[model samples]
Target: MRKLFVLLISIVVLSACAPVHRFTQLRKLPREYSENYSIEGIKAPRSAAHRKPWIVYSDRVENAAYVNPGGRVKSAEVGLLDTFLVIKTKGDYLRLIKYNPTNIKHNRLTQRKKAEYVGWMHRSRLILSPSSITDVQSGLHDKLLTAITDTTAIMQSATYFTTADSLKVFGDPELQNQTGVVGIHAIIYALKHSVDKRSVLVSKTPSLSADKIGEQVIGWVPAVMLQEIGHQVFTGTAFSRVPTLQKTLKYAPMIYPYHTDSTCSFVSGTLEPVIDKKDNHVFNINGKRISYTRGNQIKQELKRINILFAMEQSSRLPEQYPMLLNAIQNLGPFFAGSGESFSYQFGAAVATPRGMETIPLTADYEILIDRLVKMASYVADTENTPLPAWKAMRSALELIGNTPEAVNLIISVGETGEQQENAPSSIVKTLNEKNCRLLGWQLYASNDDKYNNYVLQLSNMIEHYAEYRTKNKRNMILYADQFCRSNLLREAGPNFLMLDYPYASMTQGGFLFPEKGETLPMELFAGAVDSIVTQIKADHQLLSESIDRAFATVGNGKDRLDSLLIATYHLPQGVKPNK
Candidate 1:
């Protein structure tokens, strides 16, 4: 009986041991398993296949990678400018594998405490290049450290690092001389600091030297030993572009089909009460403007206006053409009644024989729209993608003339990719010489990576151009998407603005109406559109009132017009005239 009991106990113990052994095997499996874990089936990002090296752009500890997507197990911590190779990507997450160039073997405690240095990080935490790191290291700022005393020993693990007197130290000190001068000072950048703020991991500056040693410099001294360096702060702001009443009407069809004539009349009278009527003529004293108070006699002033619409027109025109026509139709009454001749430039191509001549707004509204549509269509079909922006600017300037009488209002839609060729200084000089106030609109019609990059680059270019001069705030740019706004909006906030394209069904259908049964409320959409139009109309009327007062008080209509342009930019909420 006792023998039988022993056999049963043996079976039970073995069964328990078998499961534990399997569990141990499971634990030994690689952390980045393709078949299991949170990163299962997660492929690399479009750029990750290239295995590009990225550097940590931020200095915060939270900008770190983990063993898994669950983020429970932190494999390693990276400080500002620590670079690692991007091996894989899953949505916003990137798998970073940082190889410790300094590979020193350690025993027991020290080895176990060593950081893994290979894990998954978020894309936002990384910058594609190491320019910032290189700049700081090579800059005039001092970034070196020396042992405060001869007894100060180097450490192997930052976690267990100590500066106390001891017979034996858990680190290497080959770089330190008998005089306590550590030759690694200038080359050694303080890579990372410990949690207790007492120790730091030091490594050779990759930009300064080609030497990769087996032993990384350890931190046996407190952080106080390292000199503090201040970083240059750059603040940029992105201003939101409030659409004109005419621009808002372009999206009216998506809400519900409506005649352009009827909508124009409906919007012309619609006004939202904001500032007082007395406040409307504030621009007369500050800048030049047009007025209608002259009783049946229209003030005939030479007004130079140019519109540049540079879309990737080949593939985009089919979707955008109708809206463009609608917007132009709504703009007819405003520009036509202004008693000033206006010229319209369309597409990204060099001016054709017919396009070289300016199309006056005095032409019948319907005829004007038809001519524009046909012209834009021809230009898109004939010219290659992307309008040569600098050439186009020069062309517009030539058409408008550089004289003070020109007073050009150049509204540019989209920009070219040739940033260096179309330098900011050149653009600023061109605008100033032409007496032009530029208003740039960057369209983000798609989430395509290439398209997004193009728009962002365009935004940056506009910003650089705007920042190049402070004489006039009227030279501004508006972004179509929030992402672009967030990216560009910094300390220079006044120059950037968000131009909200209200038609969700057109731009963001997937996000707004995800399910088959989901339908947008047409009435609410129309109300929102009306609200926007009303506010825009009120702003437009205010500008008109200011112009009326300026022209009435008239010294030289041209000089007053110039001052009005400057005063218009200083409006409480500002205003964007119809394109």
Candidate 2:
């Protein structure tokens, strides 16, 4: 009897120590539907949301996952959260390595830090995609983000950063940073702005890559952020000044997730197909498990380019739908204010003059200006003219900008005393008809079309302003930037600086930089113009901050036009002052 009892005890102990049985497939629970992917190959399956770093919560395991296939269940059971850079998926299983979420909350980790791994978890346990979680912690009311810092959700979106000069993406912000997860409108706007800026990004360098634009632009923009703030200061007292332009971003696109159209190009995922009465698809937000079929699964792409992209590529696999949905529902412009403040308006304005040169003088510019005045009536709200307070503000902003000197940037050519940098005839010819030289730091020039393209941009804005005027409160800001850039350009000579558009976050949008058709939307033109105004005001602040933060990024000591002012000529170092 004693031997039999010992034998039974031994069997029980061994059973407890033996590996837990894991079926080839996980038990059916949430997301019963399944699929597989090639992990080590180029065709590894990943959703758009999963393509980037994402957050998830662990759940009560009905059937536990292992440290290894049959090892003891992992620790940190229910309340634990983590980030997974999912590399592969099969059935309900995801192949991944977990990174420290608790460490990220503490100061030990830099916000951009990744590349660490804990292990894997079942896909069913992902309570949040991170994309669906609001940056707002439920009921707390914070004004989205007035300023981004290291701990803010916006800052958390970045995985890497460098100085502005070291990087510059399309719209010139962080690239592939997974900012969409923040749910802040500005981050969304910035991400979208970065997405389709194919041309502007190309113009950024003779060539660019993930290392250049993505990492550096985010880092550099901050240092130069506050530099453009002075652009907003004017000669008026507080009373003389009307109300400040409402800092709200009126134009950011409303983003939501929904079923992608047949036009959506992603082939790795498919829109959840509707059958009889309901679908098994579900989107879990916070702890609430809701039917995903009812959400904003529809793709909201107003731009034809985006539409074409969706239609051109095959629809994604069912598993990739969430990613595809997030990709289409982009939002936010992010910065409310980003630069330095000045005491006097003119003192600041004169210090920040943008050098402008035209292709050749044209008589038609005056006609456009005349039409511009007529268009000004239409420039404000479609329902009414600008308010008295708005006019007071507008006049104050444009007063110095519309002078003959300001117009001269568009008309006359100032002489550059010295050809600081030599150009090949092709480049010189290109410079003559197209771009201006940025003779700031030491003598430097690139055969970049971005310079000449800027002139065309100015001409386009004036032309569009003359043609359409649908902006309500923002119309004045559009006029102000045009005026500001114009005045700054008057300070330029033929071989002068091209700094405004780039330093300005390339908010320089207007009428299509033409995709295919000659026709363009006045509304899009207006949106682009509004974007320019916002960035111009914002960049000054950003640059001010960056000048200190990202010091010596590109043109570290550049902006001292007063010291260089021997009548628009830049003197080499140690040159004596003009008597």
Candidate 3:
């Protein structure tokens, strides 16, 4: 009898780990509504300003003022600069290098013996501009381009990585290549020339903290960070055209559809309003928002409260939703991006784009690139002047799209091999009506080991199939792995993809979504389209009114990415570059 009990328990335990599947109810929404969300997949972005002319300058020749560039800053600040080369600029700052003098090679800047990098310097004190660049060297353009392309090629080869405090793979020498330094400048060059280039500069190999064995291990900041930036810019570009009442919500960095709320708690990032004795909900922190007129503040706070209410009401687990709603409704209007939920909504709003028409001249694209540069600049300057979130969020709000046709949520498809578009056409239709967009794959996943032969075939097909429609399926198919090996990337097309949540985590062999119906991703997102609508409709009138107004804006339309950038950074008025 005991043995039977053990066997029965084992069966139940294993079954619990499996995914649960349930039928998604189809909503009778307009066909256009559903189609709005059916966004075609885009690949990783390629640079349009490939051969564009650019210039940057430096103030002092001292090498000691250099910073460790790339991925949230992993390397310790090292020695100063002994500058020999000037390749690119981001805003006022100049990225300097020292390559061979004789050949003036552009393909790669062979690292000098002891001349360490002196990172970005202000334009206010530029040592050389466009005209002066010729004085320094006549053929600066070709040399810089070669350096950029070669360095980019080398870094794009990186595939292996570590999060924090892990031992570096010494066998992997590619990560610490001498040419990587050149590539870093190449990135700066590209970024300075065009604010919206989502280049896929993956490292040739995973090399993290080779010099430090015992220190906390994280992935190589340069390549990983560049890729992440690529994702953000691409997201901004794809979302630029989402249907909305106004364009205010369009083209900011795309947010993920789901997030792992810091240990799967029943929390919401949507701020809630606290109830008052008069039975009126005193939305917008009673006296906290003194920054704004109390009435407007109240309206904004109340709107967030409604959003939270919508979230709670949209809960798929029927058993726990009411309590969740009641508990939050009573405790409304806390701080923005705070509460029982996680920190922010960016992660939950993310969706991968396999392809899109990248309009390089658009204001949204310009804003997208500017925000990216600002974020990196802030990271590089964090030691002296840290940009606080409160101030930054306001500035970021300017980037939000104001179009009425923009989408609110994105349904990103899975990797190529998986039936990524398996969410039934009917369900997809319903999603669109509810103001959600989808990012589906260009092709199914490859069965070939690591896509070796398959990649060659696809590349060749694309090479010849450039102008043909029917032959190449779609001219721009998503490269199955957004983090595909450096060699496997497409040479052209609208290369734009986003690495968010489950996808980003999955690529690194970290956390991934559990089986369909049974997992939280399914429970949270499965019926959310209708649920969000249902709950929002029932929210207070004040909430709806505020959201309506926010949908339109004057200056730069504000959105979450802009908010994120604003929250994290603000240029200090007092600080100036060292002369």
Best by lDDT: 1
RMSD in order of candidates: 26.8, 26.7, 32.9
The C-alpha local distance difference test score for the whole of candidate 1 amounts to 0.35
For each candidate, what is the lDDT?
0.35, 0.25, 0.26
- Of the candidates numbered 1 and 3, which has the greater lDDT value? 1
lDDT of 2 by residue, 375-469 (tens): 22222223422121112111222233322211111110111112222222332332222211111111112234432333343333333332232
Off by over 4 Å in 2: 1-127, 134-143, 146-408, 411-543, 546-579
Instruction: Sort all candidates by TM-score, best to worst.
Output: 1, 2, 3
TM accuracy, model 2: 0.21
lDDT of 2 at 207: 18
lDDT of 3 at 557: 25
Number of backbone collisions per candidate: 24, 63, 91
Worst 10 residues of 1 by lDDT: 505-514
How does model 1 score by TM-score? 0.28
Q: Please give, for residues 1-579, the per-residue lDDT of candidate 3 as tens digits.
A: 999999998887775543211211111212211111112222212343222222222222222223433324322222211223344444544455432344233433333333334454443333232211111122221111212111222223332223111112221112342221222322221111111222212222122121221221111223222321121111122233554523433443333344485532222222121111121122221222211233344344333211111110111223333332243233222222133221112211111021111111132323433433333322223233322211211122222234222223322222211123132333333333323322221222334332222223222322222212112211111123322222122111122222222222111001122222332333333233333323323332423343233222211121222222222234233321111
